[model samples]
Target: MRLQVKKWNLSNHSDYEKQCGQYCYKIVKTLLNFLKFLKNENDNFNSIIEGKDRQIAELQAKLTSLYSNEHKPNEFDSLRKLITESNTAVINELRSQFLDFHNNGEIKPPYDSLKRCQNESTEYNTKVNESKGGETYIESPYPNSCVPFGNSSKQYKINVAGAGSFHVLCDAHTAGPGWITILRRADGKVDFDRDWNAYRNGFGSLNGDFFIGLEKLHYITKSQPYELYVHLKQLNGQTIHARYGEFAISNEKEKYNLIKLDLYSGTAGDYLKTSKHTGFSTKNKVNIQYAKKFNGGWWFNDYTKSNLNGKYVADNNLVGMFWGDLKILNLVKMLIRPKV
Candidate 1:
């Protein structure tokens, strides 16, 4: 009776168990395939990342090589060599011309012009042949004066108008302790009419009093010749003898004039001034004063007076004048023995 009951439901139960086993096997296979695909994708991503890193490194190396200062390639080197050679050639040519002038007694009127042209040409060539990003150094002239001393060689230019009066007073070191007075001549005598007020208060005195009529035009050609007149005056009064410095005509031209004055001594509050009756008018003016107080024969400031009878002295350091568009094209240093 039992065997007959169990056999009656056995077919359905077996079929259900077989269907569940097949479904479990399919799920396991799908999981394994998905894991394999994931592993392959990870490998591909890692390869792409490494490739990008290598590309970045290469770009960095290329940039470094392009911008390095010391490793400028063949093009820059060639350009540098060319410029060096050109400069050497130019210097040699100049030396030859100088030697030729020395050997021959030919006073050439065009020598200055030629020299200016040569200098300009050489500068142009140097600029053209120099390498890109290369640097150039040019020495400057002495500032405030044609000649420079000490540690500075700074240069500056001063331009004046045509047919106009211009004055420059520099430190005594530049002109010494001397004073210079300039006046122009018209038909005769000092013509103090047109632009005559230009010279008023040209020089100030140590006592704060200005010299009114100190300048006069001596002659026509001589007046316009750019003369330098130096005078000496007593400090306390007109009794004590002071030194009168030297003078020089730096340049004399029909269209322009230039004068240089050198003086000695160091006095305070003493200055140079022009007069209203002076024949010339002020076009451009540069005034530099040197004031010093004497203590035990040494120059000191009023605040630093440690000894009695301290006298204030004013010395002319430098004085110069230029007319008709002052152009300092070139400056040369010349060592000369002091005039006795």
Candidate 2:
């Protein structure tokens, strides 16, 4: 009787062991399934974040276009502010979530991708803000500086017959009351080492350092004869100018050729008048070797004597904003007006 009781207890113990093993297997399988679900969720989250980032990038591009216009509507400020705030909030929220996931020891996050997105957003904002020349105001309907829109502001907008409308810094108190500043380089805040398209379309701030654009220049001069004023400053605070009685340029098909530049009279030497160059050359177009050799854009023939768009400071070659033998100038400005 004792042997039988021992055998029965052993059998029951074996059955109990089997049942425990099965339960443990089920628990492990359930845990594994849960982990897989969590991993999938993490991947989905990352995909969603990436999608949002793409959307934000698209919006940023559009924003850049809106702000690139020198002139803006009255509602632009408010609209831009709202969009910026909203984007900021979204970025902040995404950052917070990313940090939370990282801390929780969940699936490994794409930290580098998130960092790249943040940096891009910041850079875009900075560029947009800088490109927005200045405050918005009602643009005058004058054809050019010749038609005076009296006392509006230091910088004002005018419409050219073929070039549409754009801003210009009026020199009401400088050499003349009606002079319109086309190019000004008070500092190196703006980069002038650019390609043909960039030089043609123009860049920089009108109220600060800027270029009035080549296409616009062509139309403005084409509509009527205009005089040129080349104002320059040395590092030692001395200022000089080169005034031309007549100046004009050809259209795009002609590579914006320097059609006429004559009757020069100013303290600064007539370097441009002496040069035999006829067309504009940028860093990537026309006379590529000379443009690259000088490290900037200008009218280049066999050689170049003046490269106003060169490096801000003189390099080893002493190639910079120079005229004649004067190199590495501190400041320079070019103004134009109807030859009245």
Candidate 3:
């Protein structure tokens, strides 16, 4: 038996072209208007361009299939070649823009965010990788290095849009005379006297002298022992809580003591915890309270007992983290924000 293939027909589509074109025309017009609207943005430039690239690629794909197959009109041959070439060119252009601006080819958006998030003051050395441009590869400047957390506490607002794993590095050996705080404000504006809630962490020797932790700012002082001072902006804020927090750590340590802060989904909710390789380990669950015995002590991982990794120390002079989930909105900037 002989089998024959049937040639497809665009004429059959004549019935739908007018209707489809009318609908698509409206969508295309809307998209163009939206693109223009996005042009006003200087902050999310990379994201905007990325979105444009995706739309271009998708539209090209659809058109290429139409022209190459069933709908191969007499006018389509040159157009098909142009669309295929445009796909390559457009993609190359997008990639080229990234390399020019970011010096990295594998970049994703929130464009300028692809660059280092540094304070205008060279003094605050939040050393970001000039090429990669993010908080992921931050480096503290010197021994006992300490800087104000999340920009200035009084002037700028550090906002977060999502929640994820993060870290804190410092002289855990010396602990430090430093602290970092993540606050939840009314309008991303932190009012020290009135802001609702926050998460704080630190390391150092002077901790007893100037540590303002989970406690509310009003109730906290450099020397206060009030742990419940957390000013709650909202409970669910953790779920979408834009990643914003205060941080302080001593650069005085001899080793980098990589403190991995893990916040992810768990049995109860989004839990924030930490881990270290040696010395003392961060408690599996955050210790929400400060008592006479475990006051400043980090939560000891129950499984590992007191030692970090496997090494044990008798010094009861450390503290750890907690666990839970929450939601936040419209986080503009923070060292530990959403998943890029």
Top lDDT model? 2
List residue ranges in candidate 2 displaced over 4 A: 1-140, 150-153, 314-317
lDDT per residue for candidate 2 within 115-172, as digits (tens), equals 7666765665565555444532333356456338444338777776556677777875
Every model's TM-score = 0.17, 0.56, 0.17
For residue 286, model 1's alpha carbon misses the true position, in angstroms, by: 18
Residues 107-166 of candidate 3 have per-residue lDDT tens digits of: 353334322221111211111122112233233232111133323222222211111122
After best superposition, candidate 2 residue 305: deviation in angstroms? Answer: 1.8
| lDDT of model 3, residue 11 | 73
Question: What TM value does model 1 have?
Answer: 0.17
Angstrom error at residue 239, model 1? 8.8
lDDT of 3 at 108: 51
Per-prediction backbone clash count? 31, 0, 52
Task: State the weakest 10-residue window (summed lDDT) of model 1.
Answer: 327-336
- Candidate closest to the true structure, highest TM-score: 2
Clashing pairs in 2: none
In model 3, the worst 10-residue window by lDDT is 220-229
